[model samples]
Target: MEELLAQIERALRIGLTVVVAYLVALWLASIWWTFRDIRGRTTDIFLQIAATLLVAVFSFPGLLIYVILRPPKTLAQLYEESLEEEAFLQGIQVHNSCPVCKQRVEGDFIFCPWCQTRLKRTCVRCDRPLMLRWKMCPFCAQAVYTPGSGEAQPQVAGGQTSAIPQLRGADPEDTGPGTRPQIAARR
Candidate 1:
């Protein structure tokens, strides 16, 4: 029984050794893949290679040190940093137009000259004018303007009734509910 117990202890130690060695190799490979400089040799590559070698020779503690010393930057963080640099190099100014007359207006201006229409921009969907304080479109229940193509058009006109007749063809009883209205008959 004592001999069997000794054999089990030896097996456990060997298994642990193999697992530790495999983990060390995997970590080293990951570091190599992550920091491999495809172009000219970079400081990051050199540091990672050195850390990998240290971990391979020494083990878990060395790998722990490497992880603590250097961490990867997220894509969003890198993009934001680049944007900040660009904004710093090239100054950015926003241009706004008068809602009523569609005339160009200064970003700081509060009123418009051409239409004297309160210098407000109306929501294309609901035709409700939005204030500078609004974060969203009040009329259409949409988010604020983004840098893209022009606004979408509304399906129906507001407040005004059309002078044209409602029906452009024979009565529904004469034709059928599914039949399309005739445009020439109205003329």
Candidate 2:
């Protein structure tokens, strides 16, 4: 009976030592990780603490649960998510205006149904949606307009006319200069 008791006491001592070592290691690791990145969420910290405690107490099963339930986002993932959200918010339509005809158009329109004009264009630099008559792409400063097409005029480089000029109005000869004909703006 004495021998059995001594063996049990020895086992208990070893188990306690292991548990203490595990806890100390976990605490130190958590502290180190917390300071490394301030942007980590509260849920992440809580999960880490829970995972550490469970791992120390129950070993393999606890680790399996932690792995399965923990968030998949790394610092890079968090940054990407924020960037995507910002882009989405920025692109949200506050108002719709036709680029080609300079008319008010519906935001959901793929093309200007009235004039059969393509309202969207790819920016040369960023490849984002650019207005067909855009003098300079809002997202990328690429010239998208052409003269004589009633498109918005792009700013001349060095104030020179070397680049294609954007058309501001219909040809002067089409309506004789002396006619003084009434003109209606598209939008």
Candidate 3:
């Protein structure tokens, strides 16, 4: 009977040893996994080493801490998000652009060169640049007229034609011999 009792005790001791060994193996694997994960997430080698040691030294609790506090995104995910934000900003700039022909114009241009679409026009009375479709000039209390409305003329200066609207009768024959032409203002 004593011999049977001793055998039973030995079996129990071996089972307990196996269970402890399994737990130790699990702890070591968790540490290794933590090292691998942190390495993949960061370019810093010191961070990887520190994370590995932190989990390894504390056994199970350190792994719990790492799991709770690790970065939500991978390095690739962060880079993708940055690229998406840049693309979104570029889209906004494109949306605010004016060139009707999709050509880029420099610095406050009144008309597009390719499509000839009037981007902005100068107020006839005030000579201030105003956007198209304004009913009245904001700078001066003058009636807004469309560029091609048969009453507005291109005022020229020093061999350069200005986009300043001039409320004049349509004179197709008179391209104007000089810089500016004094013409009759039609109603």
Candidate 4:
């Protein structure tokens, strides 16, 4: 009977030792997990050390408390969220853009401010801006005239002719004295 009791006590000691070792290993694992999780969520060194120590001292219960107080989103997730919000705000704001330079422009601008590309032509009769592709003015029923045509050209501000001068046949009547040729000089 005495020998049997001694064997039982020894078995109990072995089991107790295994349980203690397992608990210690679990406590260490919790500390490591808390440290890694806090590091991903924050950049502060003090917070990471505090979180690791909390888990190491109080084990699973401290880990639960840390989880409740920790930031919900990681640093990477916060950055991505901010980027998405910025893109959404940019999409919401509408801009009138120039086709040639893709720069922001006003609705009534005749030329792109950035590239100086001609956007519209002034109607000779009504002085309204007209699209290049339109055959006739929508505001006024006058027919639209394109450049290089022999018809009467449109006049711009300061009494300057807006059309590229007709160069097909030289008309002596068209080119009076002290006037340059109708040809466009290349740069």
Could you tell me every candidate's TM-score relative to the true structure?
Answer: 0.31, 0.29, 0.48, 0.49
Pick the lDDT winner. 4
lDDT of 2 at 141: 37
Q: Worst ten-residue run, lDDT, model 3?
A: 158-167
Model 2 C-alpha lDDT per residue in residues 1-187, reported as the tens digit of each score? 9999999999999999999999788756654543343235434666556656765565656556655665666667788898866544433243465544556677655456666665554443355765444566565334444335332423332123223222323442232222223322332
Task: Please give the RMSD of candidate 2 to the true structure.
Answer: 15.4
Q: Is candidate 3 or candidate 4 better by lDDT?
A: 4
Give the root-mean-square deviation of each candidate in angstroms. 18.0, 15.4, 14.4, 16.8
TM-score result, candidate 2:
0.29
lDDT of 1: 0.49
Clashes of each: 0, 1, 0, 0
lDDT of 4 by residue, 58-81 (tens): 889999999999999999999999
Using TM-score as the yardstick, the better of models 3 and 4 is 4
What lDDT does the true structure give each of the candidates?
A: 0.49, 0.52, 0.63, 0.68
| Global Cα lDDT for candidate 3 | 0.63
Off by over 4 Å in 2: 37-117, 120-187
